[model samples]
Target: MQSTPSYLWSTEDLLGQGATASVYKARNKKSGELVAVKVFNNASYLRPQEVQMREFEMLRKLNHKNIVKLFAVEETGSSKQKVLVMEYCSSGSLLNVLEEPANAFGLAESEFLIVLQCVVAGMNHLRENGVVHRDIKPGNIMRLVGEDGRSIYKLTDFGAARELEDDEKFVSVYGTEEYLHPDVYERAVLRKPQQKAFGVTVDLWSIGVTFYHAATGSLPFVPFGGPRRNKEIMYKITTEKPPGAIAGIQRQENGSIEWSYELPITCRLSAGLKDQLIPILANILEVDQEKCWGFDQFFAGTNDILHRIVVDVFSLQQASSHRIYIHSYNTTTMFLDAVFKQTNIVPHHQEYFFEGHLYELDPNLQARHFCRTTESSPLTLLSTSEQPEDVVGVQYRDPALDFPKLVPRVDVVADCSAAKSAVGAAHQTLRVGQALRRGRELLARGLHWVIGNLRTECSRILEQRRGAHSVLACLQLTEGRTHVLCEAVPAGGRAPAGLDVLRTRLRRVDEELSQCSRSIFDFQGALDGILAELAKDGQQVHEDKSIQQIECCLEKMQVIYKQFKRARTCLRLGYNEEQIHKLDKLNLGSLARRVLSIFQNGCVQQYQEALALHSSRMRKVCEIKKHLKRLSNRISSCSVEMMECQDCLQGALDRLLQTENWDLAAAPPAPSPVPLSQARQEMVLGMQELLEQMRSVTCDLQLNNSIIERLGGAAPTPSV
Candidate 1:
């Protein structure tokens, strides 16, 4: 019922509420963008202010697709309560998704993998930034419906996050009790000195638990009852294996346990997927933090299921290539069925060859095994009449080996215009597809660079500001010492009037220095807000114009950075002068320049490093553009060649069809000396090849469009 922050307009809807804060659906008055405003009650004291500050700092630094974006922070009311304005995730939290009755049975393996991948990516970014997200439960992972209509999982609620130092141990008891690492819980209860310091591995363990819940629709370890539930759960987490290893206990009528043993079925894991997932889960749930699987290990273990296998198919006679996506577990027959669906080739008349051997139609063997054995060798499809030896013989021969040989040419009737038009349309589609893909990649790379530069800049500024603050504190202490000296001096016998005047000037400069430091801190917050806006704009960059808009935003940020640098430089100089004056009084003037030089050198190094990273990213963007142009030209050439092949085949088919009739009694004279059966078979093969090429083109276009959409761009209209 309380009025929201002045900058935000609260809607009638309350998104959700927690014990410490209540979230409301609100809009940024200035930008007119819908957002969630999480207002924390000042009086509750449930969550400490420092915790909220830590969360704000972490969110401000992170600019990843899989992290909740913090737009702005506002303080209002007589109590000066704090409110966090954040991106509104329409789909709510993953916890809500899992709790839905329709999803109660747990998400499908594919869906679960998508969620897990996003979470891992976000966590990896956090780890790289020296941040440890101690809390990584399902409730903290939100699902946002992306522009492509796919669910994007993001990590939220970073109240328990802390910047980790390599040697410093994290001993504080934080995060949800259920998700807490056993070592952390043990240290809290027993105060054991032997407990090893937990690190990023603790987060991996929490993710493992979350993965188990998402996979099974039940927590692997659950809290049941009594005052000792925490201890019981911690004991289970430390000593027990995953629930997948435990079988149900058989109890007598009196409720005494009769027997218990290992059972795989208890976890509802299909036999085929069990081998792929069990190792990952085991590594994640390992009690020793040192042994726990990190993001890379987890990804490697489930890489096959998590990603699609790319299969390339080449038609022998048509000289056409097609790429297809297939699950690793799909059987050879299943893959063939998919290929036939695209090529429209009859299985009886077609022979698929890979790695110098014909493909066997064994339903029991998995496609993964074939790919592994063949090492992803290209597959060639030949007509039933063709022999592998003949193909080999053709490959071995070179036209230059012999003198220019004359070959007889066959002229046949065909619709050349239709073929030309199709090729032109396909060529245009390829051009558009290439541009979209390049643009998406450029934008992604540019954003990454921008974020990296921004983070580095902000960190440098923050560091400078910290230094300014220290100088100001030292100045105050020096002033206190000067006051003591002035008080101790007996009635102006030796105390100079210049010393009093200098003291007064020093106090005035300190006040100005304090104001400048405050301004720097405020600017940092403002920069965070702008960066969040830029992130949103980057997502919706559908056209060149939108891209220009983002460029303008980045330019504005650069201008702001320049101004911040200038202000910090002025404050630093002021601080240096004040320190020099104090040092002169202490007869240490020689060391003043030395100390200032060290600070200046540090700043210079940071600036140089940022510039180097920016230049590297720009070079990458240029390289990607050049590569895209080359790819576009190649696609155009391929389309032209394909069109010519289609034209020749059409002509041959027309000549052959004219000579043959459906009714044998009304058959006409042959237009050419070609046999009817051979002509018919050749025509079928040609048409199948043509169809496969067209399908591949269509698939490529659709894929490009999807990629553009995922990059927050609009898909171009298809030409055909």
Candidate 2:
């Protein structure tokens, strides 16, 4: 027996235990730094000295951000056995994350990227060090949310790892059965006689399995009675499948095994991502070992993806905000240009500001500087000329706003078979009732998002209307000044007389109108612009796929609940199309919208054309035309420049009659939209109705829960 050595760290909570050692959460006595201490038992040390020291030697030489940092080798204060102190990962293992109900369908897109980077880097590090991590499963990868709040994954547990050059082969095999390459598994576990030696590429097979699990939350190959009972069949499915199959085989209900390489619909990764990822998995999971990717080729493929991932910037607010994707390579100036595409604010006029700091107009600063991940801060278009552009110009919509993420459904179908007994039925009902209650809560969250979006849109429109009115009044003032200035100028810049004064007046009016166009477009074009903006504002709201999906689930919930027993409150939050449309509702007044509509009915296009003419012909433009307009002039001067520039006013008046012609015939008036106030009132009333229903459902759930407890169904049911 080995004597225990003095400890420099406290060991209170056991993190995990294995055949070789028990790992405990420990803190450094001096530094107070958290770490994991792996204490080797007498049985572990009883093994050959070389085998026991292999892990320690290998881990000591490894140094990479993706590989766990080794702090010190010590001894247990009590047992006097060797203990390895390593970096503590508070977030636990990737396997633990996969076990989460939300992650059962696999990690979300952003999360999967983190895992990809971490694993690839770790594996590459192992390869560079001429070391092979024979076991590369999720269980061996530890995760901790970094100071930046990103999941920092690190490879740990070098028990099965050994030094091996790329071309060199090791005779012994070491890995979890499911993740092991077919060649190794056949010899090591199945005990089949085989001459082939395991090489570093064995790790590639494990990586493919790990990625598959991370992507789909399940193993790639399976057979009837699971791998343990049907190990040979599982091997056949993996080995006998055609090259580049990337197949996932599983047993069906009727004793049939199905194989497919396609990512399931339940997978959270998008089709575009799958396009990039599936090929990589296929190359790695090749049954023919020779065709598999080496670390270099693998790095190239992953790097391509990492470099192209756009920064998904949000709007003014996070909870209720629009998500806009901008290329990661875009500079702050370029970032504003991307925002301009969505917001219609020209780049020069837009200011990129967030994080409570004005990012220097550093043209060299890339958007990726702020985006360590695919998602970044909400994008706001603040006009340099006007009062900071408020939420009026900020489009606020998130996919989360439309979709309600629910806990994974309990396995009700299996439980239904056991429903013959009172306890069974009561247990099933309890499960269904609780699931429905959770569903209602998530649905309530969806409703809250809807209400928030509606209220925000309303506030934005009101602010927009007020800003528009203020700008229009200013336009009318600027228009009067332009006319007076035009009449006073003799040569209209053809002669030097009054040219400076004329230029100053032109610049001021140009500045005023430019400011207006940046915020809400010209006063003449206000209605169409508002309507256009409205369409943009409600763009995400119209995607009702989430609502449809929710409805389908609700129906399924009803069906499942019906088989066991009926609970009226289950799946009855009164979710309907009418209530769903409230997500698109706005409380901007009907009178306000109507008045704005009347102003933009016809002359807006011609006014812009005339303004454009003055801009084009005279080098006057809001860019101060983004630079001029609404000049109400009676220019009496006979100078050629005066007549040409006078077109700004005369051309506008002449084009006024042409807009009604935009409609070819006398069209019947469309029905007036329901008053916005009435619409808002209806939205509020619907919200109240939903709240009341949820409260009622909650009460019923409580009653149902009490009944369930009386029937001795208080014990937790096993999750699916």
Q: Put down candidate 1 lDDT per residue, 415-458, tens digits, no spaces.
A: 12222222222222222233233333333333344334444444
Error of 2 at 299 (Å): 1.7
lDDT of each: 0.51, 0.55
Q: Please identify model 2 stretches exceeding 4 Å from their true place.
A: 1-12, 30-32, 77-79, 253-256, 311-720
Give the CA lDDT, 0 to 100, for residue 159 in model 2: 84
Q: Which candidate wins on TM-score?
A: 2
Judged by whole-model lDDT over C-alpha atoms, candidate 1 comes out at 0.51
